[model samples]
Target: MWQWRIVGNGGYTKIQNVASGTFLDLFTGTSMPGIQVQGWARSASESQDWFLRRVSRSDVEIREILARDTHNAANFQGFRQDLLYLVLPKSVRDAIYVKSGLKNMKDRGQLFDSDDYAFFLKVEVAKWGVNTLLADDFGILWGVMFGQKGNHGLAYNFYLNENLDNIMFFDPYTGDEKVDMEYKAYLAVY
Candidate 1:
């Protein structure tokens, strides 16, 4: 049995079905112009990686992919793709894995429940004495739940917008290549 992992590469993704316990891989290591992608056993190299452009949405403005199906929880579940894109940095990811005693992003626990993980995410950033995230920075905050007036997955600005108040929040959702969110809805108070 192999534990599957989901990694965002581009318009497409490399994921192990969290529920199916299977890996989403390519048939083989074929780099031809047009090769099919499927699920298979884990390989020694990144042969399973692929790009999905035909089915992917065109409106999505991708800034970066934080992580893949990283965490599991009710509140956090809604933001896994967002959070994965948030905590995928090598230092930050290592810090969480070490402090939370998690071998990989699939591992879940109380620390990864909800707001707790968000807090830690912020703390990790502050640890480096960095504030005001850039486009590449996938910083998220535990803000007012939907219906209120804030965002839980506050991503960074992919590019400048005409309206100064409007900032773009990108989500690495498997369903959609990327989801554009209002930066104002994002709340980060730690």
Candidate 2:
């Protein structure tokens, strides 16, 4: 009985409840890889019957009760792979890393490696521990909102650019200042 907004182009491209047999057009009706499956209204087509289970207050797990006769795409680019699960694209990951000063330090041999990125995120969160959850929540919402609203354009825009360092100081959230963990937390709750 949950409602989900469907994104992408194809046979399905609108908001519909899980009970209704509405299938997401992962390929946007075009032949592409990594097409995603989304819940829609029931059309009696077996594609819409889904089992929605609550995993946590802020998370839900969706399982398809009936397999719809749809072509599953591999490495599908824009569609959401899992419900309530945010996959950080390379661009978004890089943007966060660069903006948080992880990239610059890496070049200086001061901070290089995946561990550094993890530490950076952790330190950023610790600086504003009160807002850590909020920031994480905001990041999740931004990830999903961007996916649904712009077809992952925000993700790509922030993530897939050569001059990441150039815009590293630019914060897309406020537009006036570069995005910081504190700012992200503020935005998350507000």
Alpha-carbon lDDT of model 1: 0.36
Listing every candidate in turn, what is its Cα RMSD in Å to the true structure after a full C-alpha superposition? Answer: 17.1, 18.0
lDDT of 1 by residue, 40-129 (tens): 665544676645432111112222222121121223312322431222333443343355432234424443543444344345444443
Q: After the best TM-score superposition of candidate 2, give how far the Cα of residue 11 lies from its true spot, in angstroms.
A: 4.0
TM-score of each: 0.23, 0.25
**What 10-residue stretch in candidate 1 is worst by lDDT?**
55-64
- Give stretches of model 2 more than 4 Å off: 1-10, 17-85, 106-117, 122-190
- Expressed as tens digits, the lDDT of each residue in 37-145 for candidate 2 is 6543334443443343222212222112101102112222232232442323345444554566543443333334333334345344334434434434322312211
Model 2 steric clash total: 13
